[model samples]
Target: MNAPSPFSDMLFEKREEQAILTDLAYANGWMLDVDGCLVKTTKAGGAGGHAIGGAAKLLDWLRRNERKFVICTNASQRTVATYASHLRSIGLDIADHEMMTAATAAGETIARAHPGGRILVVGDEGMLEAIRSAGLEVTPPDASNADAVVVGAADTYSSANLNAACLSIADHGAPLYTSVSSPWFHGGVKRSIAVSSAIAQAIASVTGVQPIVCGKPSRELGESLRLRLSGGNSQIVIVGDAAPAEMRLARGMGAMGVLVLSGATQADELSGLPVDQQPHWVVQDIDELADQLQRVIP
Candidate 1:
């Protein structure tokens, strides 16, 4: 279980609308989640994804106001450049540098701790690219001298890679890193199982060692995101659909957590939770967020 957040008493409510308006107006940077908050894949197994309603316009407004932000995502099935092109095709004004992924976060975090370490990767092109780009050596699944094990939502997960991750962590104690623990992500217009979480869990089940998630609410991911912002975000608002990821991230950092109903989660699900487990605010989508910002900003 998560320790109670220091901001537990600071949770937002509709009656306290002024509090959020104040935060939004003064926030120096923003960290936005991509899978559900901003875009959704068209089908369960589609090539690319589509931007949410008014996502492009919302991003444009942020840029015009000179607000520092990054499109943080847990999905690393595709390269950042490839994902950027898909966003562009959907009319979003996103550049390659504006995006960050779980693979990227894990690579950066692992690199600083173990520079030039040998990493066993159970992922695809994007995950491989991230680790290699970080100056880490990518060893095959069955390598014995691996320094760490990094897992992503791989399209080619099999007995071979699964055996390698389990052995590396359970037997070698190499440590396990995963993208996100969320079980589902938006695919097209529906929710689909997130494979990486399943794979990580299987290894943990055998090893009795849980994997460290490196996306969304993870500080490892947050550090990577803050570095991307022009000046690190002193005040931030984390907007995303999933609570276990984005909401926990906000609580950990004392940032405003905004739950958008445009993704896997919905309004009906916000029944009740500890102050630390809930969002600071809730909106239907970025369109509503834009409306809220319009009311607050000069």
Candidate 2:
């Protein structure tokens, strides 16, 4: 398959004190972004998504080759099990263990920051699932007191829920945790603002407290990815479309970053970037790598 842009189609790797892609098969593990990389999902959490850019063929290859990989998404609207099911329905069969969400990081963060403590949640079932899985208790939406307030994506942003979250933080003098602080996440044509960040900001403004970010570029999810995919310093390659966040994360984790234009990024956005924000390798989309991997990984 031909790449969308010649400038990004190279399969080589070298860095001037910066970066490069690990020869596909050499890396012990891979971290793939979900929404924009493998599939195009609507911003509405859990909305329908379709596999794109040779996604089916590439994922099938990974499974057949027994590649160590994880599908990471910042979407926190559903549980891991639900996400796995959703992805499978879209022709991308992802297992629960191979999936990581911002909610998952939130769970880990809350567990470590406030273990066994009750907290108010402003997200969806997924957020609650992650928190509970980490052995933390969830307080009801109407409850006024809690150890902390956690926010993430939600289908509905009700007044009652907002008030409860505020009270939980104000009454208990609890801290606030948000899955992501990014105002916008890529999705379908009608781009939607990140409800989680909006909620977090509202809570912050009302309570006069700062939020502890728990999404990409945050060490919590990075540590989780390392523990799940990396085996004691084994190489990791991350392929995603988002800028700064995805690339920055890869840099911080000492992993190779590969950007696919098939998702949120465009050619114009890649101009004159700093070394720290540059992707090790740039391809038109997943199919470019798919074409490369077809020749190499097998």
Candidate 3:
């Protein structure tokens, strides 16, 4: 009859973690994770594959609560507009600004840390583009002029690149910034080195300067999303594929979390985990998530 709070035992008990479905009834809207949760991975086609089980329904729900649905994703390679267009072509008409990426988070962090400094960016064009859009100059600077060494997913973080960044950091004392430390999932295949983790390790090894990570599980990402919520933490919901990142975000922000077993995490993986590490809601796929949200959110 009544909506369940995030603290309910039926959902988040000590060893058995179930999806906290009732929490959705009270939320303003939801923050849905894109990629594996919604769009099925394609080889190169624009939009030919079928939508993930709940993706279509989720899109419908978003259409109903246009202001409430925010698409937060870790895909750092593209701008929000590009992502919005992809969603649109797939029949999910979400606004550009509604989509937040790790690139944006990394860029925002760089802006806050150094207002107008020369950046030695070590990521894809998307990462560089986000930095430039944030009103900061994106150019290779002299060692002394280099303010910070920001790294993301770039195919060319070679030894020379690392040495250059290390020199800038060691000589000019530039702070290091990275997009995230998680594994890169491109079309469902995991990459060897996460750019964030690699650059961070390189910075440490060369200049002995630790990097500041900006994406996922980080307080910055959570706070950035929290600011856009309809209400305070109580009315916010975080839907994500990873446990460490999204669930940590939920606990840190005091928001509800929905973990879907579509991407990185598996069903067997949940059998033995502590309560604090568990999600409030666990579903087989995003389609089920859409049904639960529609039934509760109206």
**Residue-pair clashes per candidate:** 3, 0, 5
Better of 2 and 3 by TM-score: 2
Q: Using lDDT as the measure, which candidate wins?
A: 2
Q: How well is each residue in 70-146 modelled by candidate 2, as lDDT tens digits?
A: 88888898888888888888777778888888999899888988989998888899899999999999988877788
Compare candidates 1 and 2 on lDDT and give the better one: 2
Residue 136's lDDT within candidate 2 is 94
Per-residue lDDT of 1-298 in model 1, one digit per residue for the tens? 9987757645544437877766875677888877677877643212367777867767877887888888777887677777767777778887888877888888898897789999998887778888998999999877755889988877778787778877877777898888778787774277778888888888889889898888767888767766766445378878887777788888887778888887766777788655666988888888788777866773
Residue 203, model 2: lDDT of 90
Q: Root-mean-square deviation of each candidate, in angstroms? A: 6.3, 5.6, 5.5
Model 2 stretches astray by more than 4 angstroms: 1-22, 44-46, 188-190
Q: Give the local distance difference test score of model 3.
A: 0.70
Candidate 3, residue 89: the lDDT equals 81
Candidate 2 positional error at 135, Å: 0.9
Question: Which runs of model 1 end up more than 4 angstroms from their true locations?
Answer: 1-15, 42-47, 230-233
lDDT of 3 by residue, 232-251 (tens): 64378878766776777777
Worst 10 contiguous positions by lDDT, candidate 3: 42-51
TM-scores, one per candidate: 0.87, 0.87, 0.82
**All models: lDDT?**
0.77, 0.79, 0.70
